[model samples]
Target: MRILMAGVSGFLGTRLVDLLVADGHQVTRLVRRPPRGPHERQWTPSAAQLDPALVAEADAVVNLAGAGVGDRRWTDQYKQLIRSSRVDATSTLAITIAGLSEADRPEVLLNASAIGWYGNTGDRVVEEDAPPGEGFLADVARVWEAATRPAEDAGVRVVRLRTGLPLHRDGGLLKPQLLPFKLGIAGRLGSGRQWIPWISMSDWLRAVMFLLARADLSGPVNLVGPAPVTNAEFTRELARQLRRPAIIPIPGLALKAVLGGFAQEALTSTRVLPGVLNRAAFSFRLPDLPTALHAALHD
Candidate 1:
């Protein structure tokens, strides 16, 4: 399959490209800068510019484009950047795909969404059918998923990946926790009861491929492990895996002070279930928390 992908330079995107290449799929990267190679295509999402010819050439298009929500302190300006980066890029791609002739349009489009769509679920388990929840990230995700309406309207099998916290030692949610936990100073956040929907990096990529291969599946799919753990449970397991005792707890107020607007999201509880993936019989390589942590740290 010929796959055109945005966000290829990101941590997940880099691995996804490698996996796609290994599986014998031709992956073309959409770059903001000038095309540096034949495999690269220039796009300006801010200007909503994407060549229809580029969309027509691909068998599928996977968009993982977005500003890193947790990458910086969430100032008002950075928050706006987070929203525009995703909504704009997705709208650009969706509109471009919609303009392609029937015969030339790609078969499918996989756009990145997030579990934050459910907002602070507390203890409630959400499936793909769940309605949009409240909060800033939820609003962002609602608009983010809505941006793909053009492609879906054009008969493209569009799938919005409501991804969870991807666990990997090198980057993502696990990286910052590693040093603190390894030093035996880490503990749960706030009440430590907020449900966390997590997935291993391996399962994340596999699920993308799984969705790509299934023409029968479309719309929003929760990309997370079967087992959802509470923040306390997750902290304990991670600390146990590292052979360290975690006793210190960071107050919710402190987190809010440090992370700013991102703190509320961090403290938000979302127990997401992979209903779509489960019904499709998609297999998870790291289905359990222990297994996922082990693979994330050791494998």
Candidate 2:
């Protein structure tokens, strides 16, 4: 398959592109710089523009493009940038795909979203059909999902990947979790009872490929571990995996004091399950938190 992806330079994008390429698929990277590999292109998402001729030549379009939510401070402007970067890039893709001639258009569009769409639901079994939660993160995810309307309406199989925390040592949630866990100071974020939806790097990659290859699957699919562990459980597992003492509990007030609105996401429970993946006959490589944490920490 000839696959085109925007933001292939990001954490998940880079891994997804690597897997796609390794699987012998021809990947066209949409980057900000000049072409560097077998397939490379350029685009500026903030401006809502891309080379149409380039976009028109693809079997599938996987949009992993977006600004990182955790990369910036929770300032109003940064928050808007986070929302616009995703919504705009997706809007651009959907619109461009809609503009394509029938014969030249891509067959499927696997767009990236977040599990944050469910917000802080404590222990509730949220699925694709669940009503979106309310708040800043939820708002960002809502608009992100809406961005793909044009593509879906144009008859493209649009799959919104509501991703969970990916366990990658080089980057992602693991990087931040490392220092505290390694130093034996890691504890539950707040009370640690908040459900932290997560997926191993291996499972994340495999599940994405599963989604890409499947024909009947579309709409919102949660890219989360089937076993949604609580923050306390996560802390204990991670500490045990790293041979550290899980002490030093950080209260909700401290988290809020330090990170403000961002702290709510960390302190609240998003008890999400991989309802779509399981029903679609997909299997996870690392289904347990202990094993996944060990591999992530060891690597």
Candidate 3:
């Protein structure tokens, strides 16, 4: 399949692109820079400008464009940026695809979303059918996923990937926590009871490929592991892996002071389950937290 992807330069995107290319799929990246090679195409999502020809030629379009949620303090302006980066890119792609003739339009569009859509799930095990939760990230995800309406209305099978916390060695949620946890200065965030839905980078990639191959699936698909662990459980497992004592607990106030609005997300308990994936019998390579941690650190 010839897949046109946005966010190819991002951490997850970089890995996904490599996997796609390795599997012999024709991958064209929509880059902001000038076209540097045959695999690159120039486009500016903020301007809503992408050549329709590019959209028409692809078998599928996977949009993973968004500003890093945890990269900086979430001020009002940064929050708007986070929302716009996703909604704008998705809207641009959806509109471009919608304008294409039926014969030329791609069969499917996989748009990136997040489990933050469910906000703080507490102890509730929520799935794709759950309504949007309250908070900033939830609102952003609602608008972000809604931006794909144009493509869906155009008869395109659109899948919104409500991704969980992906563990990876070099980058992602695991990397930042490694140094602090290794130093034994970090422990569970807040009460340590907030349930965290996590997945390994390998499982994330594989599940994405699985979703692309399954024509019958569409709409919101929770890209998470079957088992969801609490924040305390996560801390223990992480510490155990690193052979460090994790006894220091960061207070909620401290997290809020440092992470701003994103700190609330840290204290959030989203016990998510991949209902769609499980129903479809999609298997995860690293289904458990300990295994996922080991793979992220050693694999």
Candidate 4:
């Protein structure tokens, strides 16, 4: 399979490309900066390229482009940047691809989304059919997914992957978890009862490829572990892996004081479920919390 990727430099994008290439797939990256490698193609999000010939030649287009949710301090300007970055970039990609000749468009447009769309569901079990949750992140994700509907309407199979915390040591959730545990400060966040829907790095990408291969799989599919863990439980397991004591859970207000608006995201509940994947008989290599925590920290 030939795959075109946007935002190839991101955490998930970088890993997903590696997995796809190792699976012996031809990969092309649409990048913002100067083209760096043999497979890199340059395109600006503001003035994106829209060559039909380029669009039609690929088997699939995997879009993982966007501003990082956890990276910046959420000043008013920064919030706008976050919203504009994802909404504009994704809209451009989808509309451009949709403009291609019907024969030239890729079979699949696997767009990246987030479980944040469900907002703070408390303990509610979130599935693909669940309505969009409220607040900033949820609003951003709703618009982001809506941007891709045009591509789906144009006879291309569009899959919005509502990905959760991808547990990997190299970047993302693993790094922060490490610092706290190393200093013996690792503890549950907020009330500790908030469900933290997460997935192993391996399983997350594997399922993406699975969706790409299966013609029937389209729309939103929650990319989270089948066995979701609460923050308290997740904290205990993480500390267990590092051989540390995970007591004295952090207060939500304290987190809000420190992280401001972003605290709600890291400390609140999502409780997403991969219902479609389970019903389709997909099996996870890292099915439980302890084993996944071990791989993330040790291996």
Candidate 5:
């Protein structure tokens, strides 16, 4: 399959590109800068500038474009950047796809979203069908997902990937914690009761490919493991894997001081379930926390 992708330099995007290439799929990346290689095409999403022929030539378009939510302190300005980065990239692609004739349009659009949509669910289990929740991330997610409306209305199959925490030692949620865990200083956040919906890096890549091929599936799909664990359970399992003790808990106040607005999201409990994938009978390679964490650290 010929796949056109945006945000190819990101954590998930980088790995996904490698996996797709390994699987013999032709992948072209959309870049804001000048093209560095034949596989890259230049486009300024902020200005809605892109070649329509690029969209028309591809079999599918996968957009993973967005500013890193936790990359910086969430000042008012940074918050706006987070929202604009996603909405601009998505709107650009969706609008471009919508402009194409039916014969020229790509068959499917796999857009990036987040489980943050179901914000602060506490103990309530949320699936893809759950309505948008309250909070900054949730509000951003709502607008982010809605940006794909143009493509959807154009009859393109749209899959909004409401991704959870993908565990990997190289990046995502596990990288920063590894050093502290190895030093035996890591612990849970707040009361450690917050439910964390996590998936292995392997499963996340595989799931994207699965959804890319599944013609019958569209709309929001939760890319999470079958089993969800609390913050304390995750802390214990991670420490056990590293042969370290996790007893010193980090207070939420400390997190707030360090992470700024992102702290609230870090402590937010989102017990997301992969209802769409489960219904489609998609198998997870690492379905449990222990197995997933081990793979993240060791593999």
Candidate 6:
């Protein structure tokens, strides 16, 4: 399959590109800078600019473009960037796909989303059908997913990937914690009761490939593991894996001071389940936290 993707330099994107290439799939990257190679095409998503012909050449389009939510402290400016970065990229692709002739449009669009859509679900388990929750990330996710309507309405199959925390030593949820955990200074955040819907990096990559080929599936799909763990459990397991003592717990106030507006989100309990993937009979190699963590830390 010929796949045109945005945000190719991101943690997931970089690995996805490699996986696709290894599987003998043709991947075209939409880059912000000048074309570095034949596989890359320049696109300015901030300005809603993309060549329609680029969209015309692919069997599918994978949009992983967005600002990193945890990359920096959430100042008002940074918050705006977080929202705009996702909305603009998604809107650009959706609108571009809508403008194309039916025959010219790609077969499907796999747009990146997050489980943050369900704000503070507490103990309540959420699925793809759950209603939108309240919070900054929720609001962004609502619009972010909505941005794909243009393509969806234009007869293109659109899949909103409401991804959970992907476990890996390289990036995502596990990277930052590795150093502190290795130093035996890491512990749960705040109350540590919040549920973390995490997936292993290998499973995450596999799920994407599964969804890419599953033409019958569309709309919101939770890309999380079957078992969701509380922050306390996560802390304990991580500490055990590293043979570290998780005695230093960080207070919510400290997190707020450091992460700014993102602190509340960090403490959010979104117990999301991959309902769609489960029903579709998609198998997960590492379905539980222990196996997922071991694979992440070891591999």
User: Which pairs clash (backbone N, Cα, C closer than 3 Å) in model 6?
Assistant: none
Least well predicted 10-residue stretch by lDDT in candidate 4: 46-55
lDDT of 6 at 198: 96
TM value for model 5: 0.99
- The 0-to-1 C-alpha lDDT of every candidate, in the order given, reads 0.95, 0.87, 0.94, 0.86, 0.96, 0.96
Instruction: Compare candidates 1 and 2 on lDDT and give the better one.
Output: 1
Native-to-model Cα distance after best TM-score fit, residue 93 in candidate 6, in Å:
0.5
Prediction 6 TM-score vs. true: 0.99
Query: What lDDT score goes with residue 274 in model 5?
Result: 95
* Stretches of candidate 6 exceeding 4 Å from the true structure: none
Output the TM-score of candidate 1.
0.99
Alpha-carbon runs more than 4 Å astray in model 3: none
34, model 2: CA deviation in Å? 4.1
Please provide, for model 3 over 6-32, each residue's C-alpha lDDT reduced to its tens digit, 9 standing for 90 to 100.
999998999999999999999999998
lDDT per residue as tens, model 4, 1-299: 98888878898988889999999999988888888889988777766554555567798999989888888767788888888878777887788788988878899999989998999999888799999999899999999999997788899999999999989888887786787787887688877898988899889988998999999988999999999989888888887777888776788898888778888788778888999899878889998888887788767
Query: In lDDT terms, how accurate is model 5?
Result: 0.96
Number of clashes recorded per candidate:
0, 1, 0, 1, 0, 0
Which stretches in model 1 have alpha-carbon errors above 4 Å? none
Per-residue accuracy of model 1 over 1-299 as CA lDDT, tens digit each? 99999989887999999999999999999999998999999999999988888889999999999989889999999999999999999999999999989999999999999999999888888899999999999999999999999999999999999999999998888999999998888999999999999999999999999999999999999999999999999999999999999999999999998998899999999999999999999989889999999999998
For 134-247, candidate 6 gives per-residue lDDT tens digits of: 999999999999999999999999999999999999999999999999988889999999999999999999999999999999999999999999999999999999999999
Q: What is the lDDT of candidate 2?
A: 0.87
